[model samples]
Target: MDKFNRKSIVLLVGLALLLALPPITIAMEEAYFISLFSRIMIYALAAVSLDLILGYAGMASLGHGAFLGVGAYAVGILAFHVTEETAIPFLPGGWAGSINAVISWGSAIVVSSLFALVIGALSLRTSGVYFIMITLAFAQMLFFFFVSLTTYGGEDGINLDQRSQIPGLDLADDASFYYVCLALLLAFVYICYRIVNSRFGMVMRGCKQNETRMRALGYSTYRYKLICFVIAGAGAGLAGALIANQSEFVGPGLMHWTRSGEVMIMVILGGMGTIFGPIFGAVALLLMEEVLAAYTEHWMIILGPVLIFVVLFARRGIYGFLTGDGGRDG
Candidate 1:
């Protein structure tokens, strides 16, 4: 088999092996670990989306967390009334409850994409640090707006009454949720692989490396960047929705700039330039958080210096440190 096919086979084998593991359920006491992993995967998905625009498409957006917030709230608010309605109100008549969750997710993507469009349009007019600042400004706008809302958690957050039920499935269980997140994670990785290997993704990557050169080559790199930003925003929104469903909760903290910074750290720590790097980064960070927090309440005290050390020494993060070639391997 060719190198790529061989790699694919290996990955399939790994997945099959995981599935064959005796179905292990987290005990009630240890269930939080599974939930934490679910949260980490959701955040990792958002970071991967950011990598597509920032690492691959030459865009800097500080408001990416806002899109995640958009998604989480979409699920939380709809699940709000879903139990009340025999049918979902989020959709026009026929699509309430389980179907409403899907529709709300769709709306979240659409809404976040529209917001990204406006943000990218305005930010693309600037370059470098200015672009970053503008994105941050938009994020702050949303953050403050969410904080000011008197209803729906406002500054504080609330939990869902119960998990949103799927039409023909019972995914509310912790193990089931973990499996669902795993499926989405694998699907997203495959989608990202396809995107990076495609012509459109090539143009986006070219813009990131040298926008002027791309423009001189007769492509409007701004348009490409904007398109990528919208897609990334939509993807982040989807991640948010999944997270909300996972927790049966939503909060404004999901949109805070600190949250944005955390995602960047995860992306960089895992390997920002590589497609699968962010997943490793996310898992590592979450694992650290879970493990360290067990020993002490001040987990960030340990994490802070470790992240800096990695940034200084590893440079390209764990993936780069492990695979020095640093180019796409799989």
Candidate 2:
């Protein structure tokens, strides 16, 4: 009970700080942090989505970054057509590009979900290290595929002329965009929290704990995991769209296996299976990179030991340590 209270307090205060960041940064004339923290929240959204599978469902997907790439591409390609005043040749009805956030970002979520569907369908057939390798292989396949698209700048990637339009909102304003990202993050976190507490979440976690037992009980663990994978992919897709808008660019690097590894690190470092923990992990890891990069080029050398210390001693990660709770969701 005490631990729950502490966790609740920390989460509330953390959210409050996020809410107040724009004013705080503006007052200090550190307005650049608005963009930086916006990027952090976008990655946080991706990390939380990864935690859905890696933490609760025990799925180690090394290719999850592919979904983000696919999503960003959706935005890029559509905007490309709009910029060039051309329609996609392959599709009938002369479908052209659109800067509409609803069309572009919605397509991102849908297309990414479909990508996850195909990937999860095949990937879930294996487990253990084989699963990891297959996911990595798929991610590499996608990375190279995007690199080959010379029209999208090949390895150089594509750039957006403007941010996606949101109804009555100026995404061009850093503070406005930050709040939108914050609102979306809160919404998705709430969704994940409900999911991890629901019957489906129970089955998913049970599969993680003892798949054999779940199968013996007549539960089709594959189906549950696949659904969870799709859900996570959708969340990641949204993050990708935000990334494209935030950076005004989308590159093949988004699909790189190393990117997936970074997101995985955020999940584990934040506290796997705890919905709110990865947010802190995202904040901590990114802030470390930002601050450390200022001091030296060899920031990663310093980061290695900090991560090692967290992994070795703070087993429950930053949030878990703060709240005195075990890392698991339940």
Candidate 3:
């Protein structure tokens, strides 16, 4: 079979396996794995968003976690208001709800995109390490801002009484929620695939390859990069919203620099610029974390070497290795 057919088969099999997990979990009485995989799907979404900018656009933002936190906080804050029986002061009609997934997730994406616009406009002026630092600084600032909000549990974080409602779905059930996450993950991956192959994606990739040439060719690379940044932020915000529902908690920790680093690592480890690579990286890293943590607390010590080996030998990441497409730009 050709490479395309092989990849299609692999993806189809992976999807089938995920789809079968709920029934298998019921049989094995292993409900916890369902939740675990749900978390993986959420982070995989985040990693894919990061790949859009970091891998395709050549924008090494270190503050992507800020968008995730923004989305989580959107849900957390709205839920808090609902629980308190108070209307949102800033919202014109005093909108208040406990489990409106659409509103909360929508707010997350909008807020994160606005934040991205502001940050990108400024940070894009600088390149290289300066850009990275600026993004990190902005994320840290937002992290502390949430930390100072004593009304929302501050550093301790806030918990939702329950997951957000999705019409007739029972999000409280692990199996049901796992399917929700899995479906959203598949949708996000498909969207990213489309974006990475379209005309806009070509322009973004061109900017990554040779910005000066693209600029000389009359392409406004800065604007394209900023739009890409906003798109990535919005994607991360969606992941954040899903994660907040899954965990039923939100905190400043979501925006911590380390979280951003983890997502970046996922992108790099999964083969930069490859649409499906980050998903592979997320699963590998998180699964390793879960399995190794059970055996030893110092799992990072072991994982550190594994990451190094991938970086040095499998430079294209696990997805690249599996597909025999190593060292080629996806």
Candidate 4:
């Protein structure tokens, strides 16, 4: 088989194994694994979204976690009104009596996209460290805004009384929710693959490679970057919505700069610009954290050195190393 086919088969096998995890955990009577993997999948989704802008488009956004928090709060705030049987405060409509997962998720994406557009439009004018600092500042602003909103529990955060209703699925069930997250992750991966291979993706990459040349050729790199940023924000919002449901809570902490750093780390550690790399990174980092935490309280002390070693030696990250694609093109 060709290299492409071999790689495809490997990815398929890995996905198959992930799909089997719920049943395997059930058989072993280890229910916590389901929750753990579900959380991993959610973070993986966020990381994948970050990879699109950071890896493919060469936009080093340091506040990507803000989108996640926006999505979660969108769902949380909507559900809060639903439970309270009151109209959304500041909206023109009547009480949003029944909370629907579909609507909630859609709202999350829309809200995050809007936020991304505002941030990207401003930040894209700058480059390098300026862009990173501006994005981080915007994210911090939102974090504090949410923290000061005492109605939503402020620093204490808000909790859902129940998972949003999705026609027939029992989202409250851990296994079912895990499957939902996994399905979304697969779909997001496929969508991102298509986007990365399309004409728009080509232009975005060209701008990344040589922005001056692209501008000289009459291409507006700013617009392209802004659109890509919005797309990534929408994806992160979806992940955040799922995470809110999974944990049955939402808070400003989701948008914290540290959380954004974590997702960025996942992208770099997995293999920046590689579509499937972030997923591998998420699994590896989270799993290592779990294992190391079990052995020591200062798990990061050990993990930090190991990560540095990988960066120096592996270069391509675990996925790239394994696939022999070291992300040189990326």
RMSD values, in order shown: 3.7, 1.0, 1.3, 1.3
Please write out the lDDT profile of model 1 over residues 114-192, one tens digit for every residue.
8778888888888889988888888888888888875567887657876655666666776677777777777777787
lDDT of 3 at 153: 93
Candidate 3 segments whose C-alpha is farther than 4 A from its true place: none
TM-score, candidate 3, is 0.97
Candidate 1 CA-lDDT value: 0.75
User: Who wins the lDDT comparison?
Assistant: 2
TM-score of each: 0.86, 0.98, 0.97, 0.97
lDDT of 3 at 217: 99
For model 4, what is the error of residue 137's alpha carbon versus the real structure, in angstroms, after optimal superposition? 0.6
Instruction: Compose the digit string of candidate 2's lDDT tens values, residues 177-276.
Output: 9999999999999999999899999999998999999999999999999999999999999999999999999999999999999898888788888888
Clashing pairs in 1: 88-96
Q: Write the per-residue lDDT of candidate 4 for residues 52-113, one digit (tens) a residue.
A: 99888989999999999999999999998888887877677675634698899989999999
Q: Which candidate achieves the best TM-score against the true structure? A: 2
Badly placed stretches (over 4 Å) of model 4 are none
**How does candidate 4 score on lDDT?**
0.90
Comparing 1 with 3 on TM-score, the higher-scoring candidate is: 3
